[model samples]
Target: MNSAVIRLTKCSSTKCLAMFQLSYHSQPKVALDEGISSHRVQVGPHRLHYLRAGHGPHTLLLIPGVLGFGWSNFKHQLLGFDRDLFTTIAFDPPGNGYSRPPEKTFPPLEVEAETVAQFMEALGVESASVLGYSSGGRTAMVLAALHQRLVKKLVLASTHAFILPDEYKYSRSLDCIEETWNEKEKNILYGVYGKENLPKLWRQFNDFNERILKEQRGNICLHLLKDIKCPTQLICGQKDPLTKVENSWLLHALIENSRIHVYPEGKHSNQIKYAEDFNMRVQDFLMADEELSGTNIREEDIKLAKANSF
Candidate 1:
């Protein structure tokens, strides 16, 4: 079938929510033998790089934290989850992956959020569920809170609603990358962000630990979190030093209709270590028939999975 133009009703504000029409041009399903495929779309000045797996009814966008790319961070989800149930897209925010930023100051939250919305629009997606890890999780919150119609459900792992302390300044200190990291974590970092400074396609993360704090300027989405009415899930490791388990509790407290999961003995990179269980839980949450919405936490929503000791 020939690809057709996606008509987005022009909105006065560039960052309009799911305000326009999306052509119901059904995306082709991925064959069982097919592997994940890379995709690119012009989102404003940046060209976003994302990987698409599955062609199911529900759309799920995976956003990664600082020093991480969606394709690398959420690979298991694309490979392991029931793709027939949901189409998943893992994206690299501007500068992190192949999505290059314009030459100027790095963009702030509003800009980043706009990029996400425009990205969806480019792909003819009126709205989709968003799953963000670490800093990207906070971005997902902003996307849902500010652009309500654009997100159906939210899954936030290793995310927080609070801003860094005033004294927190990062200069390749890997601050946003999480200080409580192991060698495996370091390898992931080096591979994703530091591979080719000027040597090739990776340079954005070479500048800071987390670019958002320094470059992006907008409310940290804390104020509008309660305003988010979508069914949300909050996840974190009990031992994540950068974003503590208590922070996850804070998000759970503020966001109504939210569930919380704490992986015992898990670190900031627990998502990588526990991919199977983590992806399963996320899929279950997204595909669940019934989810209660309120500040009240359900017994099952609270998971305290213990990590095995070495």
Candidate 2:
């Protein structure tokens, strides 16, 4: 028997677009009635593939990294949050996963923000708390700015607001004209989490970075982040090599009623790596804070949500 060694890299090309399946070994077996449901939405030239799960008060709208999608990367999020307490939703942005790719340049963050608004409206959800990771975080900021009423609160993980001279180089969009995805590209994919977890991390990084670089324009993220006004939470790994600390400072300063949290030994993927702590902090912030809070959630209820396996 041979064990597969998946390698991730910082490649920005089309050749690295390999179809890899994620084994469901990471999630716990505590049945929570969490499965994926999909929908097709038209946002300008792009048709987005969106996923939804669970049910409760205060819907959580999850936005994944540039090209990341589905529940695999967001397993911690889906599993950690009290599914019976809050309705959680995650989706594939344009040009990734089951979603349609862009026809022209990738839609701007503002445009994508509107698309999200449209999605909520179509589903009859008046408002939701926006949660974004990586470039998705930047997009959430944009959504809050454009649809302030619909966005009650915001959460950002491993995201940057504006370009820093030092940090811009790390983004695949800034480094290349058109990113190509291939099996062999030396990127932060493999070594993002030291050397031991390189194989797993590499696949995750390559799956996201490769497609995002080819389809997205980096400036959209920078411009839209400056306009946020909702209560926001920014979480980052202290050891994140790509997004520097200064960017979080700038985001916190620009966005009103925003807070920042840094995991001591965490990296860019801290939310996944430190799922227990990360989920606890998020639950605490959303429930305790007056501005961000609405419905009351019991801690005991969170611990005991069960799936109806009928």
Best-fitting candidate, scored by lDDT: 1
> How does residue 158 of candidate 2 score in lDDT?
86
lDDT of 2 by residue, 126-235 (tens): 98888888878877888888788998888888887544445444543333312433322223222122223433333444444444444453233544544566778888
Q: Where is the poorest 10-residue window by lDDT in model 1? A: 301-310
Task: Encode model 1's per-residue lDDT on 1-310: one tens digit a residue.
Answer: 2322233233454443222211223212222224456666877767777778887999999998765776558767777778788888888787764454432234556677888898899999999999989878867988988899999999999877653543133223443433434566555544434533322222253333244455543125556776788899887899876677766776776677788888998877667879888988988889886764655554332331111000
**Per-prediction TM-score to the true structure, in the order listed:** 0.72, 0.66
Residue 46's C-alpha lDDT in candidate 2? 56
Off by over 4 Å in 1: 1-33, 101-106, 164-219, 295-310
In model 1, what lDDT does residue 90 have? 89
Global lDDT for candidate 2?
0.60
Cα distance off (Å), candidate 1, residue 14 = 47
TM-score of 2: 0.66
